[model samples]
Target: MFGSLGLPELLILLAIVVLIFGVNKLPKLGKGLGEGIRNFKSSVRTEEKTASDENGQDATKDANNT
Candidate 1:
């Protein structure tokens, strides 16, 4: 999606963000956004792991029953 945005467009976007949020709050906003993304990524990974584990256990149970 961002493949079409050139440097100038990115700079303009950054300028708009800075104008809207101001420089002082940018760091806090960035930190919160980062933490949110991190948490989301970790949760997704954990969910995928649990799903795979469950599938593996079901397969094993089926094999043993047979």
Candidate 2:
């Protein structure tokens, strides 16, 4: 999707962000965003694993019941 954004477009976007957030706060903003994304991804992985484990257990229970 982002393949269409060339250097000029990226630079313009970056400029807009810098103007809005200022250079001094960029690092803090980036760190927070990175941490939020990491936490979200970790939770998603844990949830998927839990769902798969539940499904596996259910399948075995059904087979034994029959």
On residues 1-66, what C-alpha lDDT tens digit does candidate 2 reach at each position? 999999999999999999999999999999999999999999999999999999999999999999
The TM-scores, one per candidate, come to 0.96, 0.92
lDDT of 1 by residue, 1-66 (tens): 999999999999999999999999999999999999999999999999999999999999999999
Best by TM-score: 1
Shift of residue 55 alpha carbon in model 1, Å: 0.4
Q: What is the lDDT of residue 41 in candidate 2?
A: 100
- In candidate 2, where is summed lDDT lowest over 10 consecutive residues? 9-18
Error of 1 at 30 (Å): 0.6
lDDT of each: 1.00, 0.99
Clashing pairs in 2: none
The RMSD (Cα, Å) of candidate 1 is 0.6
